[model samples]
Target: MKYISYYHNPRVSNLLRIVSESPGLTFTEIMRRSGLANGVLSHYLGNMEKRAMIRSKKGRKMTWYFLPHDPIEEDSIIISLRKETSKNILTFLLTKKLATFVEVTRAAKKSPPVVSITLSQLQDLGLIKVTNGFVKKYEVANPDTIMRLSEKIDSTMFEKIKDRFEDTFSYF
Candidate 1:
């Protein structure tokens, strides 16, 4: 466990504070909320990361920034789900509990191929698994951890992402 000293610069301190408050926000979210320019924010984050003051979970589309030392377990499943599409899929599965591929495809409003790839990715990350039973359903490996980890992220951001996915379901 590394103990990092506080940042002297206010902007850097503010960035750290923001990440601490919203542990699972992406780089875009941070920029939007912090009102910091790309180069400046990037520089501060890089410094923080090198000092072990902050850490990030890199996703396919974007990296989810977080404090290096958080109370949450920082499981790989949670890290992987930091990606927008993956988080959207997990949110869908968590709400429905158990769903078939067709059902997920319909609810997520994502193309069949995209949904399929996301499902396989989730399974590979150990966040979810496909049942071997007759129905061949998908279910989260640990709903409890998902729920707990969900509490650490910004609800507004999560809701926005969720709403976009839900809108797809509404289309059908």
Candidate 2:
């Protein structure tokens, strides 16, 4: 599975950082620190938990939010690609590394017009290089950059997750 860039999402990123730095914070505490409404915070927390970025323990009256020992990595290529292309196109690209226009349309499950526009936007961002032909070839550009960014993102994510888990669950 490829790692995506959900970390760039402000709500998710902030919650992870805060929980990692200070575990076992109640919903109120997280809201106070994060400056997010209870509903928004809860939504982000739920998404993170689904992603295995964090876990929760319910006590008598209070709920403690903690990070999981292992957090899943997002797809670096897809994340970066989305910055250049539409998310749908990026998802298709992930499944089909080098695809023709027709292939992208099929994989993206979008109309040809939409796929073409997205491909053009990505090409403009230099995220993908395209060759014109009966069957155009589209290749991912700056793979090294993507890899480097992935490493950086994963390192930061793991560091935060580790810190949160230790702070909340460690028996030292």
Computed on alpha carbons, the lDDT of every model, listed in order, comes to 0.77, 0.64
Model 1: weakest 10-residue lDDT segment is 1-10
Question: lDDT score of model 2?
Answer: 0.64
**What TM-score does candidate 2 reach?**
0.40
lDDT of 1: 0.77
| Cα RMSDs, all models | 5.9, 17.2
Candidate 2 lDDT tens digits, 24-57: 5678878999999888888888888898888876
Residue 131 lDDT (model 1): 90
TM-scores across all candidates?
0.76, 0.40
| Model 1 spans with C-alpha error above 4 angstroms | 1-6, 59-61, 71-75, 156-172
Error of 1 at 136 (Å): 1.1
